[model samples]
Target: MELLEGNESRCQNMFWMNKDVFIRLCDELENIYKVKGSQRISVAEKLGMFLYTLGEGAGNRNVQERFQHFGKTVSRYFSGMLNVVCDMTKEFIKPSDPKFKSIPPEILGDYRYMPHFKDCIGAIDGVHVRATISPSNQVPYIGRKGIPTHNIMAVCNFDMQFTFACAGWEGTAHDTRIFQSAIHNLALKFPKPPNEYPQMKWYLGPYKCQRYHLPEFRRGAQPTGYKEIFNHAHSSIRSVIERTFGV
Candidate 1:
């Protein structure tokens, strides 16, 4: 209760989100998703406990101590909260413009990308997230990172909000493998723009085997030819996904 009623910074430090956002999230979970507070604990406390575990990487015992609940109570609420949040993904993580009718404000306002990248809706990339698995099942999950990880493929808009995410591929799985699976699976509802703009692709990528990253072009030789120039711009726009993951 103290954390919930405390100052903004305290709430953010503990929950990784502002107090108002946390309250709004709880309200959404209750009103929209039909998540109810248990007889002993409120929804806010349940969410706080879950977020605390994620933010601090705390174990069940740590959660029990912090929330002053029994180990079983902590574990139960944590699992419940996780399931509820997962259910919220389809509602929350989707494109602002599903039809891709309007040009993104980021592309429209910036002259560098205005005319060229107006068709680009978002960027896609994969990131490696560490996974916890049994020792017997660890080999398939170990890849170039040399750790048990899941390759999470995500698409983000220019504003850096995730529009779609597909997870569960092992670390050794290729990005193309995950992407193919996502697009092929009708249930995943992978975002595919309308075919009105047949002249250009809905998504763009830098030229393969070319200098693509911004930093490389920055320190070394400047982009010269048309392909290099185009790659630079493509890389610049695509960097939003990298920044989103970085945050």
Candidate 2:
């Protein structure tokens, strides 16, 4: 708590939020989860311990040492906080209206991206997040990068804000397959275009998806003028997803 009040940068690095935001989130968590203080630990300390462990990727033992608590206590609070956060997802993450027409002007005005991508609502991509699973589950979690990971499918709006995320899929699974599963299981939750203009709801994605693809220039052949222009625009527009992931 003293550290959170001390340096702003340190607070951001430790918990990924400013002190005010952290306090607000703590208030929300207490309201929703009814996390009462125990005789040994306060509610604020429990929330801090859990967020520190999550934001810093620190192990339970590390959090125990940092917070001056036993390893079991750190693990208990962290697990409890995780469950509470999961329960609050629907309250925090929500999609825009189906008839929403708030496309970024930067994208709309760009000559390279305007006409072709005017209907695109967002960009969808898969990222590998490292995971540690049991021995029996390790085989399915080995990604193409030869690491144990979860292939997380995400959708980012034009403003680079995450609109949707589907995680916990096996790393060996194809991105398209995970997307299909999301559509099947959570179709109602996904944003849809209005009934009058169904085509307006589209997401830009990699070539593997059933969407537009950039022209491939063969080693020995020159690309046509239209192909060159289209490919350049496609790459430029799709780079937004990469930038979002980098952030």
Task: Please provide TM-scores, in order, for all candidate models, with all chains considered together.
Answer: 0.89, 0.79
RMSD values, in order shown: 2.6, 4.2
lDDT of 1 at 184: 71
lDDT of 1 by residue, 1-247 (tens): 7877878799999999998899999999899888888688998988999999989878889888988999999988899889988889988899988998889899999999979888888999999998887799999999999999999999999999999999888999999889878877789998877773534345566788889889999999989998999999998999999999998
lDDT of each: 0.89, 0.72
Q: Can you tell me which runs of candidate 2 are displaced by over 4 Å? A: 194-228
What TM-score does candidate 2 reach?
0.79
Tell me the tens digit of each residue's lDDT in model 2 across 1-247.
Answer: 6766798988787888888898887787677679788898888888888888767778877887888998878888888878887767656545554465666676888876777777766667889998878788799999788988999887766677776778889889998798777765654365544443433235443333222333444333443466455555666677677778899
> Can you give the lDDT of residue 240 in candidate 1?
96
Flag regions of model 1 displaced more than 4 Å. Answer: 196-203
Q: Name the best candidate (by lDDT).
A: 1
